[model samples]
Target: MNSSLRSDANTIIERSIQAVLPDEAVRRALSGRKFSGRVLLVAAGKAAWQMASAAAAQLGDGLSAGVVVTKYDHVKGDIPHCTCYEAGHPVPDENSFAATQAALDLVKDAGEGDTVLFLLSGGGSALFEKPLVSGEELQNITGQLLACGADIVEMNTLRKRLSAVKGGRFAQLCAPAKVFAVVLSDILGDPLDMIASGPACPDSSTCAQALAVVEKYHLTLSDAAMECLKQETPKQLDNVETQITGSVRQLCAAAAQVCRQLGYEPVILTDQLCCQAKEAGSFLASIAKTHARPEHPMAFIAGGETVVQLTGKGRGGRNQELALAAAEGIAGMDNAAVFSVGSDGTDGPTDAAGGYVDGSTRAALLAAGLTVHGVLAENDAYHALQKTDGLIVTGPTGTNVNDVALALVR
Candidate 1:
């Protein structure tokens, strides 16, 4: 491994995550916003706890009552006047239902002149759900969509129709009251109506589109689920206004800043990087080879989410798969390395944020009886990375802004 380059990558990753934490962003979004009557807070997603804490601190006595529904282990502490519940992510569980019900109950009492301060972030679709279909069916459908490698937009489009709280239905429940939504975008283009299935914003997806996704993916759905998708979601909402706090673009910019500070000439390839996990890694590795002889050290950055098709039952995430796949391409280039991480600090079902791969990674893994193709085919980047000490663990970063992948050539 190139220790210096790895060190630089770690520096960029830590500082970049710090730059996007929702503490300051939430406070900034709440500034100058006027609220009347009762101001209730409903926070959801991986970053919900931190966002709620910062908002509670800012709103103080003004926050009448609040409910926080986040991923399991995300609630770090108590937020006064607010109840926090940790649920599931990537998929919603029974706990998700109960916590979402709490949020709904909190907002259902909103008066005509009241304001519902809805703090939203990525992963909310699963963490903030009130499923219209049976919970079992919802889980099955979600798993199918995931296994089929559906993108965020496609997944959320189908999710919005199946959930009572999504597709602006939550805003409807807070009817006669205004909803001020603070969002942290994890999807490309910052589509307010799509992020986290847009619980507060009116959904832009149509019944046909939802059906199209099911058809395109050849997803098997229950009769009840099919009916739900056939029903159209709310296309417009009058009582909701939105403020986007951060996104992948900011993540890329922050990484670039850190790279420059560390003396690497950074090039932000794109903030809209959307592709298969392995494909992205291979492409980045190819870039490293293309610039193998640069006069100065260089960093290439790509920020956004990637999809992974389930070929095996082994545990891993898109970010981990991305990093591991790059190993082969840069196998003997001692000065090259590639790493990818989810800003949320948890990737897939694993506790790791992501994985890293230096030029020596391929050889080291082979020495340990692990081949990149064999490991990746089982969708088992986590264990393979563990063998090479390549996993990146940064438990519960209290933020979500898609992901960042980097290629360092020194």
Candidate 2:
């Protein structure tokens, strides 16, 4: 491919990924549904603002009242009908506690025939934090989990037990009222009860399972948090009608279509990819190396979340770590490039969305006196990739479809 064609392909890929936001997909799904009763909208996530806005636009005067909670930097668009609140992510703050309480209050007194619309997506777990334990205790436990590099599922398992609104508690609150959940899945396989700690779905995980997670990671939780976990159990409700509107499968399918439109052979490896970030990266790198040749121009795509067991106090998200790890496997192989990014446009605690790496990344880092081994050991892929201008920075995309990793061979 020529320079112009290559650039066009890259742009197409990025645009296609961005087009699959949860709000857009949810709007499409709700287009035909009609209800006579008043619609009460309640949503929470990094993409909650966008999702709520789209729903409001579609619902128009049909919406009675609404409330949504999202991350601090993720609020976007306008929804005059719904109240929007911003809160901390990865770790819940006082703002999160207040927002969650308000959301619960909004639905607490719903009449038997009232209709409740619940929009859920990634980062909702942190955006609406109502701890069964004390606020300080929840904060400390959250900090410990982040430091330990627990994956989203494991972290949420523990979060559900120690919260007043997580697991199936939210659904139980809206009992007898007709509840409809519009979800943007961020978990591998789009587990309904895992995303956003399954606020509006049945939680299959038990307190015993949550305890196992804490013990497995050696997480030190405060006495209050531990007691909360031991004492609390989410009430299951069967009246909720849940629907997942967007996920990794949707994003990967869109990406594959774009690649095919650009006249490249597109192959989807998996939409449920999970494991260590580095191991996943190496796996992608191996595929790229095998397919990189003059006669074969191919695009391989995979979607899902990866875990990083943090040993080093470095700044990086799973996508950055995956890119850095793949660099080692694809070293010395020309005509191969790999790009991995979170669909949400924010990876971990850092600002950058993700990172891009190629066969030349290793040499570039070494030239700058950066040791890849040391950086990977400390989970500092962001800094290492930043030195080489490999970080893919896109502010907040206002969408969550897990993470997308692509390998291009030409």
Candidate 3:
């Protein structure tokens, strides 16, 4: 019975990922749209290659010049009529700077009648950036923001001010040319200004908000980065059309369907679950504990991005930590299981998509001489899950819609 439940959980997660892939979403968005003149493609994010490849299939020979910047190893293969570059994600590297420069150059030369097809997805804020400050200073500030436990919105609020191409600046660079952005949103509320720092959409975040984040986190920034934070981002954008092709809401719906098919009563807890990683895990486990029964089977689904305040020096993503915490909460509930996975198939800096924990997970760890509390306290869920075979390694799924977490009770 436990094995069957695990299989069902995996199937639901896979269905959720498939539902939000950029390929189908981009193709559907471009079905009736027609461009008169040249189409310049610029894509950036974890799903950049997949989205750009899908758009290329539709544009055919109409695509003039294009640039694709994606996370390292996310570039599956060559994108026809487009140059693909792999860059750092969660943190911008030197390659990210160079590739973003190329993307800006491609859009800068767009003529009056041309169309700039911006293929955006999650992680673009880091994958596509030309900093207003030096590369070293930019990297330093980004590291500080991440380690400071700031949420995506808070981190992006500061990023918009620090980047030369963010906060509608990229759209401004492509002035006179119509800009249409097909986005695969990984943001909690699907805020256009927050996704990828709103390179092609107007930024609603002000310098004051950015400053507040810095003060809240007590982040120490370089002089140049500090100065950039005081400057204003572009609050207005011209000739830009933004369309959200995929989101966490869609991901949760797909997972719920799969759960129903698997003979579990599907309950969507919330599609906009925003909280600390461990807190989210504990909450889901609490639901599982309440519903766990021999005769009753239920699946609780939640989707959204979760933040993690890094207090330990050990390694693990937010999803991994969430699963570990759930393990503790559901330790004695024999029929309960909880799983969390990022839609992009890479959570935090780890190769694992996320983590999974069953009622036996905690005991299994103890049998193996591992302490759940100690592992979680050190933020070492990756190694702990690996020992218990709780790590879900899906590699890159070529999609991004934040994260989907499910707790099943039988």
Candidate 4:
């Protein structure tokens, strides 16, 4: 029965990812739009290669030139017309700097009669980093932010101020040319200007807002990074056509479909679910407690990213934290389980995508001599789940649509 539940959970997650792939959604969105001039394809992220390949298949002979930057292991061979550059992610390296320069060059060379197709997905922020601040400074600030447990939005707010290409600067690079951005949103509420720090979209965030995030997180920035934030650059949003081709809505819909097929009523709690990881987990667990019964099977689904304020050097992501926190509240409840995971199949710096917890989780942990408080205190939910054999490890799903959490009450 446990195996069956795991399989079902995996299926739901996989289907959610497949539903929000940039290539698939972009193709559909572009079907009606007319592009008569030269088509220049520029894509970046963990799914860049796959997105590029899909665009190429749909574009066929229409694509005139192209370039893409992706994470080191994500590149899959070379496209005939597009230059594919593999770069570092989560932390920008020298290769990411070079790739950003190359992408800028490509856009700079685009003519008024050309159409630039910019494919953006999650991880683009790290894969194509051109620092407005020094590389060393960016590295320092990023490390501090990670260790501090700042959420992705807060981290990205600082990133946009530090980056040369982010915050719609990439779109500005293609000034006179018609730029169409196909974005796969991985942020809560599918904020087009926040996903990947809005490389090709207009940023609504101001320098003041960026500074505020740093202050709120109590993050110490390097001198160079601080100077970059102080620079008064007017917000620019012109001649760029930005559209959210995919998002968490796709994931929720997919999960809903699966629930229906399984003869369970699926209630999409929200596609914009956002809050502190542990708090959100506890809230969901409470909701499950009210709904769960022996005779009725129901699935509660939510999408959106949650924040984890790092208090310990534990090896876990927000999803793992959510699952663990929920476990604390639903310890003795039968016929109920809570699962949370990043849609990208990587949560934080850990190999496991996320973890799952049920009424039996507490008993299992105690049997294995694992104390819940110790795990939670260390932010080591991943290890706690591991002891109970509840960690869900799915390496790099190649797509991103934010995070997903499901509460199943049967």
Candidate 5:
């Protein structure tokens, strides 16, 4: 393995993550905004704590009662007067329902002339949920959607229909009070109505659209859940303003800058990347194979989340699967390396952030009596990458933008 190349890649990724942190983005988005009367804060999702903390720092005493619900371990410290709660993610638990109810009450009680500042980011769908159906039914449907490889948009479409605060219902609950949201988008294209299931923005999805997603995924839902899916989400929301503060586009650009500094000609392939994890890795390897030169190193960067269809019981996330697939394409090539990371610093249910692999990775696996095809076929990239020291573990990065992939050929 080329240690220098791996180090450079890690550095590039770290810099990329720093560029889109919720604190800086929130601070910039709220600058020059004037507010009247009491300001109530409701922050939700993976970056809720960071976003709320930054806003509290800026608003100080102007900020009144507040509540934050985020993924487990996201809370860094106290946010002055805000009460922070860690909830379940990728799946909702009892805490998810409880915390969401608290947020709903806070918004519902806001009177006229009051300002509701919502700090939203990715993972809100699972992190903040008040289901129209039973919690067990909601969990079952979510698992079915995920196992069948439903994309974020499709999954969220169904979620909006089954949720109380999502799909503009939260904004509706705030009524006469002015609502302003600063969002850190983790969705491709930054669809304002889709991020975090559009809690405070107008939802454009229809009941028919949600039903279509269920049909597309062949999802089996309980009668109650199915009945809820037929209900329309809030289609229009008034007295609400929104600003998209961060996205994968900025994440990719930041990585490109670091690549250039490392003496590589950076090529940003796409920030809208979305596909099967293994297929995306193979595609990136194709790019490296075509452009790699001995004289000039090249860095290919892409950003966006990918889906994993769980066909195997083996443990692995999409990013790890992607890198392991790339290892196959660049097995014998020298100075070719590939790495992918979830901007939130966790991939799937694993503690590892993602995976990294290079030309030497395949041979190393063979020496350890492991084969790429075997590991990937079982969907066990985590263990395979661990054997080659290719796992990238960065616990709870305190932010969530999206997933990023980088291919370096030198």
Candidate 6:
């Protein structure tokens, strides 16, 4: 492994994540916004805790009440008047229902003069849900979509149909009251309706599109779920005003800035990378092989979320899988390394944020009787990277824009 390259990668990761944190963004968004009566804050997703905290500090005694629902272990501390609840992510669970109910209740009796300060981010589909179907069925359907490699847009399209709070329904529930939403986009292109299933934004996706996703994935859904898919989400909403504060584009820019500071000429390949994790890794390695010049440091960056088609039962996330898959293509390159990490600081179900690979990583794994192909086939990049000391762990980054993958050549 190239220690210097690894250090640079770590610096880029840290600085970039810090740049995209929602604290300043939230404060700025709320600065000039005026509220008539009540400003009831409802924050949901991975950044819910952080966004809520910032809003609480900004609003102070002005905030009438607040509710925060975020991924488990994400609630760092208490926010002044807000009731904080830690819930499940990627799949809604019992706590998800409870926390969502609390938010719903907080806004249910809202008057026309009241304002719902809805702070939304990625993972809100699961963290801020009131399922129309049974909770068990919802979990099963979510698992099926995940296993079949449905992308975030597709997953949320189907998920919004099955939930009472998604697809602009939450905004409807907070009806008569205006909603001022500060959104942190995690999806490529920053589609407002698709982020966190767009609880407050008008859903552009149709019922046909929802059914198409189900058919594409061959997802086995309950009868009630199928019925929900046939129902159309709200096509238009007038009570909500949205301000998009951050996105993967910002994440990529931050990384590129750090790369330039590290004396590397940075090229942003794309900010909309969406494909199979393994294929993306291999493609990035190919770019490194074709572009790297001797003694001329360069950084190639791609920022977007990738999908993993699960054919194996092992544990891993898309970022981890992407990094591990790059191991073989750049195995003999002394000055090349590839790494990918989730902005949320958690990859799949593992503790590691992502994985890293360089020229020596392959050999180290082989020395431990592990082959890249074998580990990847089992979908166990977490353990494989662990054996090679290639796992990148950043616990609960308090933000979620997307994943950023980089190929470093020095």
Clashes of 3: 0
Between candidates 3 and 4, the lDDT winner: 3
Give the 10-residue window scoring lowest on summed lDDT in candidate 2: 1-10
TM-score computed on alpha carbons, candidate 2:
0.94
What C-alpha lDDT values do all the predictions have?
Answer: 0.93, 0.83, 0.89, 0.81, 0.89, 0.93
Supply the TM-score for candidate 4: 0.92
Name the regions of candidate 2 deviating beyond 4 angstroms: 1-9
Reference-based TM-score of each model: 0.99, 0.94, 0.98, 0.92, 0.98, 0.99
**Which 10 residues in a row give candidate 6 its minimum summed lDDT?**
287-296
For model 1, residues 1-410, the per-residue Cα lDDT tens digits are 77887788788899999998989999999888777689999999889999999999998899999999999998998999999999988889999999999988888778899999999999999999999899988999999999999999999999999999899999999999999999998999999989899999888889999999999999999888899998888888999989999999999999999999988999999999999999999999999999998899999999999999999989999999999999999999989999999999999999999999999999999999989999999999999999998999989999999999999998
How many residue-pair clashes does candidate 6 contain? Answer: 0
Model 6 pairs whose backbones collide = none
lDDT of 2 by residue, 1-410 (tens): 12343364457547866778766687886889886676889989988988898889899898888998998778775686788899998799999999888888888888787888999989988887788888888888888887776878888899888887788888788877888988888888888888999988778887888888889988888777777667555556777888888888988888888877776788999998888888989899999877768475788898888888888889998899998998887777667777788888898899988888887889888888887788899889988988977888878888888888888887
Off by over 4 Å in 1: none
Off by over 4 Å in 6: none
Error of 3 at 1 (Å): 10
lDDT of 1 at 122: 96
Question: Candidate 4: deviation at residue 195, Å?
Answer: 1.8
Q: Looking at candidate 2, what is the lDDT of residue 314?
A: 91
Clashing pairs in 5: none
Q: Model 3, 1-410: lDDT tens per residue?
A: 16776787788888778877888789888998989989999999999999999999987888888999999889888877999999988989999999999988887778999999999999999999998988887788888888877889999999889898999999999999999999989998789999999999988988889989989988888777778888887777769997898888999998998888888888999999888899999999998877767466788998988888777788889999898889888997768899999999998889999999998899999988888778877888899899888888888999999899999988
For model 5, the stretches where C-alpha displacement exceeds 4 angstroms are none
